[model samples]
Target: MAVRVDLNLSLDGIAMPANQTAENPMGEDWGRLVAAYVGTKTMRERVLRDTTGEGTTGVDDRYAAAYFDGVGAEIMGAAMFGLHSFPDDPDWRGWWGEEPPFGYPVLVLTHQQRRTIDFANGTRFEFLSVSPQEALDQALRLAGGADVRIGGGVGTVRDFLTAGLVDRLHVAVSPIVLGQGTSLWDDLRSFDLGYAVTSELSEAGVNHVTFAR
Candidate 1:
């Protein structure tokens, strides 16, 4: 099975906002970076679970739809799972409400041990303190022959990339620039040298870039 990473980052390669507070979990820069993806009709239907058919339907929507394709299981960091800001809040589910978009199993990587959470939908979250390889092994087992997606908050993606565990990676580079934030390419110099790279400019102005090995 293929291990893929799909992410949205600023023009400066910042994946997460520098100042993320409880009031603004994704931070102020998050809106600008993911505006295009969030505005797509596919995101509205899938993530928002809206049947209103109220969103843009074009190149941006096509990329947004592709994001969820072939993804049977997901592995994400605690921050991506919304545990960084609300560590003590046991009732905190995640940024996504009751019914999350990811209908597949999700493995959350965290230092602290916690019980597994299963939603009414097919979304099952299991917390693990293991290394990237260990977590990927568990995720692969649950993936059911489909590809496992590396859903990230920057650090998680970097860890997988550094360990050479990712086979395909797609990054939507927004036109905005975040002067300060957690960067995805911090120590990843020449990381794309071995991968076949391609880029396409979406109608919303974001560059849809992909790296496949």
Candidate 2:
């Protein structure tokens, strides 16, 4: 049987704003958004910080922690992995500190292969310059019966969901709006994607909703 799992968190209409910086007009208020969504949880660990600088007020921190708590392996996009084109600078680590939040093995989807990056914190980033199916296979192998998580930049998540790979999804809809930026629902064709509400909470300005597919 397929591994039962949960992928949690939300974005503005499923799209990453054009510029993710805090100063970017398109950037969402990270602190309020994070708190409103992922609230206090025992296993909560803050993995990705809003490069927008609302780290202390992170709304997604709780969810990221809870989600990571449930997964054994992670698959992320090249951009989200911090190797957009190429990391020519060895001094340039990802958006995270020396030890990234994803302490487990993280498989990054890329077109150009690169060497593995091993941090002292037991976190390792392996470049998977292969198709999504190949990457998923590798992730499952690394999972060793544990659940696999498809980390996102929207496109990656949509791809897996459309292929019926995602078992569940959690989204925290923040109240703020971005007049223009990348939209989460951009080219997704409609299909019978059904989700049952698992839970709901309100904080800051947004509503946090959990859906089981």
C-alpha RMSD for every candidate: 1.1, 5.1
The local distance difference test score of each candidate is: 0.90, 0.61
Off by over 4 Å in 1: none
TM-scores for all predictions: 0.96, 0.73
Which ranges in model 2 have alpha carbons more than 4 Å from their true place? 1-14, 20-64, 85-87, 189-192
Q: On residues 1-213, what C-alpha lDDT tens digit does candidate 1 reach at each position?
A: 899998898999999888777788888878888899999999989988889999999878888988889888999999889888889988778888889889999999999788888889889888999999999999999999999999997899999999999999999999998999999998899999979999999888889999999
Q: Which ten residues in a row have the lowest lDDT in candidate 1?
A: 19-28
| lDDT digits (tens) for residues 164-211 of candidate 2 | 676666666766655555554556555334766654444454555665
Query: Number of the top candidate by TM-score?
Result: 1
Enumerate clash totals for all models, in the order shown.
Answer: 0, 8
TM-score of 2: 0.73
